[model samples]
Target: MKIVYKTDTLPHVQQVSELFRSSGIKRPYDDLERLQRMLEHADVTITAWDGYQLVGLARAITDFSYCCYLSDLAVQKEYQQNGIGRNLIRHLRDLLGDEVSLLLISAPSAIDYYPKLDFERTEKAFIIPRQA
Candidate 1:
């Protein structure tokens, strides 16, 4: 299973929506326009592709100086056990370098997973929930 990772390519809404659904990451996949805006606004997007298939993705909005909000991280259910998610995080880290710290609001299902990847857990975060 040769999965190639890229930072330059952005997958279509359908591809990302499909991946999100399959990965069980709840997002506005049914709202194609919202998904399109998300893709357009993200400063960093790394995708893992098995040939033409998008198996995993890491999308973030970063200032490239201090902190990065890792807005999304998802991998196809069938591709979960592999190192795709970790590799995707690694890719983000490598790109952001030593100066930036990555922060994400973990899905309930992914709470344990982040720590395994060396993500420090912090209770300091607060968010004004999005109602849409």
Candidate 2:
């Protein structure tokens, strides 16, 4: 199964919502409008496809100069363990260049996964929980 990656395109919202649910990501799958807005506003999006199927995605908001917040990284369950997620981040980093700092708030289940991918764990971050 060959995967094609694209940076200039975004998969349909239904496809992305399905992938997020299937990949066990903590997102508001029931809120289609919110999901659509998420994709529309993200500054950078990298998607992985097998033929026409949306298999993986990495979505982020960035200024392209200082910092990048990787908001979502989801891969279809069947497509996991194949380095698709890693490669998606790699592509984002390549596009962002070395001057930008990449950051993400990991789901509780994925806390260990980031360090394995060379993402530094930080205790200095804070957030105001979403009120949705």
RMSD of 1: 0.5
Clashes of each: 0, 0
Error of 2 at 101 (Å): 0.4
Tens digits of per-residue lDDT, candidate 1, 15-119, equal 999999999999988998999999999999999999999999999999999999999999999999899999999999999999999999998888999999999
Go through the candidates in order and give each one's C-alpha lDDT.
Answer: 0.96, 0.95
lDDT string, candidate 2, 1-132, tens digits: 999999988789999989999999989877889999999999999999999999999999999999999999999999999999999999999999999999999999999999988899999999999887
TM-score of 1: 0.98
Runs of candidate 2 with Cα error greater than 4 angstroms are: none
How close to the true structure is residue 100 of candidate 2, measured as C-alpha lDDT? 98
